[model samples]
Target: MTPRDLLRSAGRNTFRRPLRAFLTIVAIAIGAFTFTVTSGLGTGINTYIDSQTRAVGASRTVQVTGTSVMSFLNERMEVYRDDMDTARGMDVGSGILGEEDLQRITSALGPDDEYSANRQVSALYYSHDGGQRYRFVYNGYWPGKTANLVAGDQLRDDTDQAQLIVPSYATRPLGFASAQDAVGRTVEIGVLGQDGEVRTVPGTVVGVQEKSLIGGNLPFGNQVLDDALQDASWAGSAEDDAQWYSSVLVTGEDPDRISRDVAAQGYATATAEQTVGDYKSIVNGILLLLNLLAGVAIVAAMFGIVNTLMMSIQERTRQIGMFRALGMGRRRVFSSVALEAALLGVIGSVVAVALGVLAGRLLGPMALDLAGLDLPGLELFAFDATSLVAIVLGVTVAALVAALPPALRAARMDPMDALRENR
Candidate 1:
């Protein structure tokens, strides 16, 4: 028989036992549905991570934090008294990155490399029109990296001018009509001093930052503005110690080499790519576990395929003998049975892919809304062509393999024996 003829015959034979074939197809569909949806979830999350990594300037930049030896010790009594005494004796400059360390880092860099130091600020208070003050946390904005801005512009690192970037969500609370309206306006920021006094400083609102999963609550400012606030808090207090930075941001052409070099200087470094990679690994691991559970359903479906094919073979013993008595070869008979199994797989996969894609698109947003996560520019479902093709091929292969034993038994049967036994 021609391949086309064999395919036509196989398809007709598959549905001879309609209930059994339908049940087997349903079983395979369950597996395909699980795999496709889980893969979509992984793709969506990784895509979001990629976008966030770029938003935070992670592509060309690395965050460096001073390696503190005391952090390695536990807070319990297991920490020796001598260790505690030594930690106490270490100055603020010793434990964190100081001026000397910053200078060393800069000197080691090439002319193309740029760096920004993050200064710590405390007890920041802000108000619009000099009324109804609100306290907020602060984070130093690195001018070397691009900010994900919703309005206005990034803060200038070169200027000592008091400029601030307000969070997008804070615009309405700060009495602005919108994020754009908040830009080019003056807002008063006050630092609570050690002597119970609030020293107010007026800063121009140069930009408004979009809400982010990371660093959403805190407002950002340039080095000059951060320094002014820190200095104000330190004035009139015995805490007039040398300035120590919280962390440093560095940008270089070769991030791997820079990370190693930063580590050699007794500081820890994290790149944006590395951070995203770590998050992807975690997301992939969870998806893998869920896929495995779905695999269980596919395996059960395989057994169903095997049983259905075996029963069909038994009921068609005389028909098979008649075909062999004709010009039909054993290989053709095997091919026919295998093609039937493959057809069932194709049907199941088509149904599954349609359902899975629809579910992923609809349920993703609903899940996010239920969780109350207001992450802007996040898509929870993303589908790719490669993944869909893979799902179909995988399920088809599994179904064909399960039909193998039954096909072999039918193919090897003697025509006279099969006829006599059936009679």
Candidate 2:
């Protein structure tokens, strides 16, 4: 038979067994719908984690901390192509990175690589002015240190003058509306220098800054927590010698590997990849459980399809015998059955896609409400081309899987036998 004729026959056969066709199609639709929704949610979660990690500057940072000597070369470098025998451990505390180490690491990195080094001293600050003391955590810096900035400029390179730049919103308490307002103003900071001296540095507000979503926050400082003391220019400097920093920031391809190598050099590295992975793992684990439950609902639906198809076969036995008696091939009969199943799959998938998109739009706002923060620029669901392809493939596979047994059973029927059964 011609392909068009086969399709026409399939359509007629489907309607002739209305209850069976309805049940099978509904099963396919349920499976397709569940798959689309779950997959979309998975992609959304991954995107959300990426955004948060990137927001905090996770990928480009490899947080370096004191490690046991044995931590060095803990595992063999089997994955690396480089010769490790000639590589020596670089000690961070020894100040080997002052200038030369920076050049070497930068040179060793591919042409695309760029890096910045900083002695990150975590400290607390509060508005010294009696106006309203706000406590905040900030990354202390030496004058002119390069921390990636999002809004304002970095501290000047040539001066010993201390300077500070904060997020755009940081200026609200400083009697300013934004980073532009805080710029050029003086801000008081409580910090400890390398000499273990506690002192407050009344630094000029140089610039505001933003970092990339794939990189992280500024290297020198971040938005202070609510409890960190907020100090204004009127507040006199206070010093504490307890805080110390042992970290450097780098960005490029294989940032995580570079961080591992930096740890080999003895300086602590902080990269965003580790942070993003941790975030993804946590979210994926939770979502995976939810998806599993959704899968159960779909599996139940597939069994319903099986029952519907079985009934369809029995009802069409006489028709099958007539076709076979007329010299129609068993394979031709099988094709008709399979095509019907596939068409149902396609219809279900199309409907599910539409429904999933609608659901995602509605659900995203609710999810954000639960998160308790407004994500102004963030989309509720982040599905890309890959996700779209996956949905189509998944639906098609489900249809074929459901069709196989039924199609085979129909094809195996004998003309006389099927006719007798119809009686």
Candidate 3:
């Protein structure tokens, strides 16, 4: 038979038993659907990290932190893990960050590198225009810091006016009409000092920032504002020693080299890229595990396809003998069965890809909204055309592989034996 005629015959034979064909296809689709969704999740997250926040790691900045050596965290777990790595064996106080250690951290950097200590601020409650108090989360600004702003500018190191940048979500809750309106508003922060009294610090909102898939939604503040908050954090405490800083930010032309140099000084350092890489690794690992599960399902479905084909061959033994008697080649018989299996793969995978893309578009935004935060530019399940195409091809090849045993059995049958099998 011609290839076209063979294909047409295979297509018809594939659905001769509709229920069996459908069951086999459904099994394949179960696996393909899982793979499609997981693959899209990985693609979406990696894309966001690369496009929107790659600067976080690529900007040549290293975050340096001193390890904590003591903690009695039988109750206060959050306290022990807020800023430092509290996982260490018993030591006589591993001591606070001494001036000598601080000096080493700064001197280890190249001449062109800039250093800025982080002022750790504890929990804060802020109010606007005498309104109700709301929880405040913020990070101090450094020279390498960036903000994707909807209005105004990023925190300037040159400014001493205690600048603040709020995310768009904070605009309405903080009593502002719009993102532009949120700018230039005074925000009053009420913090509980170490001495057990409330200290209020004020900062001016100079910018409104955009929300990102990877970037933290915490507000950004200049050093001036951080200094004020730090003062509030330490109010009424003894002035017997200089303030201890657990972490610092270092910016330079080469952060990896600086990280190594600083590590030599008994301090741990992570470049922004390394931090992002760690996060990416976790995401990829989880997706890989999910993909493996899907692969197992696909394998199970392959077996199902094989069973379905074997049954079809059993029912058509005399038909095969007739085809061979009519001068059909063994290769064409094998191709016919294999093509039937490929047809199953095509139908199953196409259905999976269609549903996966639909779920990504329809459900992705609804999920984002249900999260109770506005993630304007996030694509939770971004489907790539290349990935979809690859999935279809992989499944088709897998189906063909599954057909091998059945196709071989049919092709190797002697014409007389096949014809007499009915008797």
Candidate 4:
């Protein structure tokens, strides 16, 4: 028989026992839906993390921070921890980086390399619109990468006036109705100065960003703001300047070699890849477990496909014998059975992927609301063309594999015996 004729026959046979085929398809769809959603979540998170990492640091960035008090190597460098986040940044066990310390840290680097300092700073209180002042924290690490702007513009390098980017979640708490409202507002920042007192400094809110894991509740400051805060910080004080320094950042193509060289100079280093990967690993671990559970569903669906096709073959014994008697080749018979199973899989996967994407668009925001999170631009169900196509192809291939036994049985039928069996 021709391929088109065989395909038509398979399509026609797939629904001979409509209810059975329907049930099998349902089972496959369930698994496909779960797989689509889980994979999408992982993809979305990884994409976001990668973009953020690029903005915060380069592939070859090596962070040169203060000495690690936790290190038993006689305080060589700041201890690196995967779990360390912005919330626990200041409390991390590390000695101060002195001015000489910055020089010492950079001196170990190749002359072609340059560095940026992430001096730590705090804002005791912020006030706008004459409301109650709320406390906040600011960091000096500047990616000048893509800014997650909901409103206004990213901090301009051309200007040095203290400019801050507030997170979207903090708009209401900071006396703003919306992200747009928060922009361009002059606010008071209380920075602790060298003389041991909090000084109210004026700054403009240039932009607002999405709430992020890496940054936590922290707002970002431009270079001028960072320097001003650093001037008030412990490491920035002239009296302690010679004895302490903050985190210094620089880029080198070969981080392993760069880190090794720095270690010889009595310093420790953290690459941007390592720091970002730790966070990605945490995300990946959870997604892996979720995907595994989805895999279980798919495996169960395979059994459903086998059972459905076997029953179909048994019901069609006489029909199979008649087709064999009609001079149909064994390969054609096998192809027909296989195509029926593949049709079921194609329908299931297509339906599942379509519904999954729809659910993501409709219910994604509801999930965030239910969880009491205000993370803007966070999509729980992101999908791409490649992955969607892969899901369909994978399910179809799995269906064919599962139906192999039934197809072989149908192909090997003895015309006279099968014709007489169901008589």
Q: Please, what is the TM-score per model? A: 0.84, 0.70, 0.81, 0.79
Q: Please list the residue runs of candidate 1 whose C-alpha ends up more than 4 Å from where it truly belongs after superposition.
A: 67-95, 99-111, 158-160, 192-198, 215-217, 233-243
In model 3, pairs of residues that clash are 57-273
lDDT score for residue 369 of model 4: 86
Using TM-score, rank the candidates from best to worst.
1, 3, 4, 2
Models, CA RMSD each: 4.2, 8.6, 5.2, 5.5
lDDT of 2 at 149: 50
Across 217-269, the per-residue lDDT of candidate 1 in tens digits comes to: 46777667777776665555554445556677888898777777877776767
Between 1 and 3, whose TM-score is larger?
Answer: 1
Give one digit per residue, the lDDT tens place, for model 2 in 1-423: 999999898888777767766766676677666666777777876776565653555354444444321234432222322332211222333222334455545554556655444434424453423345445645433222343454567555455555555654456675666657677776665644333444454656777654333323332433231112222211232343122223345556677677767666655454555656756677788777766765675566556655666678877887887888888999998888888777776766777777777788788778877976454445556666676566656666666677778888888887896568757
Candidate 4 lowest-lDDT run of ten: 80-89
How far out, in Å, is residue 113 in model 2? 9.6
Best by TM-score: 1
lDDT to native, each model:
0.77, 0.57, 0.78, 0.74
Please provide, for model 3 over 7-67, each residue's C-alpha lDDT reduced to its tens digit, 9 standing for 90 to 100.
8999899999999999999999988888899889899878776665643533677877664
Runs of candidate 2 with Cα error greater than 4 angstroms are 17-20, 48-55, 58-62, 67-122, 128-130, 139-161, 178-180, 192-198, 206-245, 248-257, 263-269
Residue 184, candidate 3: how far off, in angstroms? 1.0
